[model samples]
Target: MRPLIVFSDLTLDGYMTGPGDDLGFMVDDPALEAESTGELRNVADAIVVGRKVFPEMSAYWTSAEGDLAHWMNTAPKHLLTTDPSVDTSAWGNTVLEVGDGIERVRELKAKQGGALVVFGGTATVRSLIAADLVDQYWLKINPVLTGAGGSPFTALAGQRRLTLESARAYSSGTVLLVYTS
Candidate 1:
C-alpha cells in the first residue's frame, strides 16, 4: 500500500490559523519551502484533500506560479467529498470521489502509486489520524505564536504516539518535524 502523509503548517502554539483565519503569522521562507516541498514532491505523485480545502487550494494553486504550483496543477488529485455541489472542473487530472472520506483514502492507498500527500485539510487529516491511516506527518512549526486559533490536534480522540523520524532547523527559525505513527 502506498504511504499516506499529512502536511500542515502550525504555529508554535499548535494553531493552524490565527483569528479571522489570518495567515499573516505564517513566515514564508523561500529556502525552507524549496528544501522541504522539493523533497516531498519528489516522492509524492498524488495529492489528497477534503472538500472544504479543495476550493481554496484549487483556486490558489490553479493560477499560482512556481515549481510547487506546477506540480500541484499536474499531479493527480483525489478530492474526497460527498457534496454533489462541488465542481471539480477547475483543476485538471482530478478525480471527484463521493462517499466516505476515510474509506476512499483507504482505497486510494491500496492502489499502485508513489505516496499520497494531504495538503491543507484539518478535519480530513484528523479523521485519518483517528483511523490510524496516516503513515507520516510533515509538520512545519513556525516561530511565531498565535495566542488562540484553530488546531488540527483539537478534540482528537484517544492517543497517538509518534516516533520522531528526523528534525531539521531552517535558517528562517522554522523547524521541520517529521514523525511516523
Candidate 2:
C-alpha cells in the first residue's frame, strides 16, 4: 500500500482553525500554500477529502492557475460521504465513496498509486487519525495561539505513537513538523 499523508495547519495551541472553520489566524503568505501543498502534489496522484469541505476546496482550486491549480484540478477526488443525494457528476473528476472509510482508504492504498493525500473536514481527519490509518502527518504549526478552535486529532479512539521525522521552521514563523507512525 502506498503511503497516506495528512497535511494540516495548526496553531501553537493545536487548533487547526478558529471557530466556524476560520483560518484567519495564520499569517498571510501566498508562498506558504504553494510551497507546502505543492510538495504533496509531487508525491500524490489522488486526493481524498470529506464531502463537507469538498465543494469549497473544489471551487477555490477550479479557478486557480499554476502548478498547484493543475494538480488540484487534475487529481481524482474521492469524497467520503453518507449522503445519497450528492451528485458526484457535478464535479469534473470526483467519486462518491460510501461505507467504511477506513476500509475504503485501505483499498485505495492497496492500489498502484503514488501517495494518497487527505484534505479535511474536521470529522474526517479525526476519524482517520482515530483509525490509525494515517502513515505520515505533515503539520504546519503557526506561532500564534488560538484558545479555542477546531483540532484534527480530537476524540481519538486510542493512542497512537509517532516518531518525529523532521522539523523545519519557515520565515513566516511557521514550523513544519513531520511525523510518521
Candidate 3:
C-alpha cells in the first residue's frame, strides 16, 4: 500500500493553528523549509486534503512560485468532501471524492503511487489519526506558542504510540520531528 503521511506545522504548544485558523504566528524559516521540501519531494507525488482545507491550499499555491508551490500545483490533489455542489474544475488537477473519507484514502493507497501526503484542517486530521490511516508524521515545531487553538491530536478515538524516527533542529528555531506508527 502506498503510505499516507501526515504533514503538519505545529506551534510549540502543540496547536496546529490559533483561534479562527490564525497562522500569523508562523514565520519564514528557510532552513526548515528546505529540509521539509527535500523530505516531501522524495516521498510523495500526490496530495490529499479535506473539504475545509482544499480551497485555502488551492488558492495559495495556484499562482505561487517556489519549489513547494510547484509541487503543490502539479501534484494531483484528492479532495474528500461530501458536499455535492463543489466544482472541481476551477481547481486544476483536482479529484473530488465522496463517501467515507478513510475508505477513499484506503482506495488511494491501494493504487499505483509514490505516497499520499495529507495536509489537513483540524477535523480532517482528527479523523485520519483516529482511523489510524497515517503511516508517518512529519511535524515542524515552531518556536512561537499559540496558547489556544485547534489541535490535531484533540479528541482522538484512542491512544496511538509512535516511534520517533528522527529529530532535527533548524537555525530558525524550528524543529523537525519524524515519527512512525
Over 74-133, each residue of candidate 2 has an lDDT whose tens digit, in order, gives 889888887867876645788878877778888888999888988787778888888888
Model 1 TM-score, all chains together: 0.93
On TM-score, the stronger of 1 and 3 is: 3
Error of 3 at 112 (Å): 2.3
Candidate 2 stretches greater than 4 Å from native: none
Ranking by lDDT: 3, 1, 2
Cα error, candidate 1, residue 169 (Å): 1.1
**In the order shown, what is each candidate's alpha-carbon RMSD?**
1.4, 1.9, 1.2
lDDT score, candidate 2, position 179: 93
TM-score: the better of candidates 1 and 2: 1
Q: Model 3, 66-171: lDDT tens per residue?
A: 7888888888889998886787775688988888998999899999989899988778887988888889999988899878998989867778899999999888
Q: Compared to the true structure, candidate 2 yields what TM-score?
A: 0.89
Residue 17, candidate 3: C-alpha displacement in angstroms: 0.8
Instruction: Give a tens-digit lDDT track for model 1, residues 1-181.
Output: 9999888888999887787666678788788777776988877899998888788888889998887888999999999999766789999888988999989999999999899999866778778777888899998999999898767776568787999999998888999999988
Q: Estimate the TM-score for candidate 3.
A: 0.95
Better candidate number, 1 or 2, judged by lDDT: 1
Name the lDDT of candidate 1: 0.86
Backbone clash total for model 2 is 0
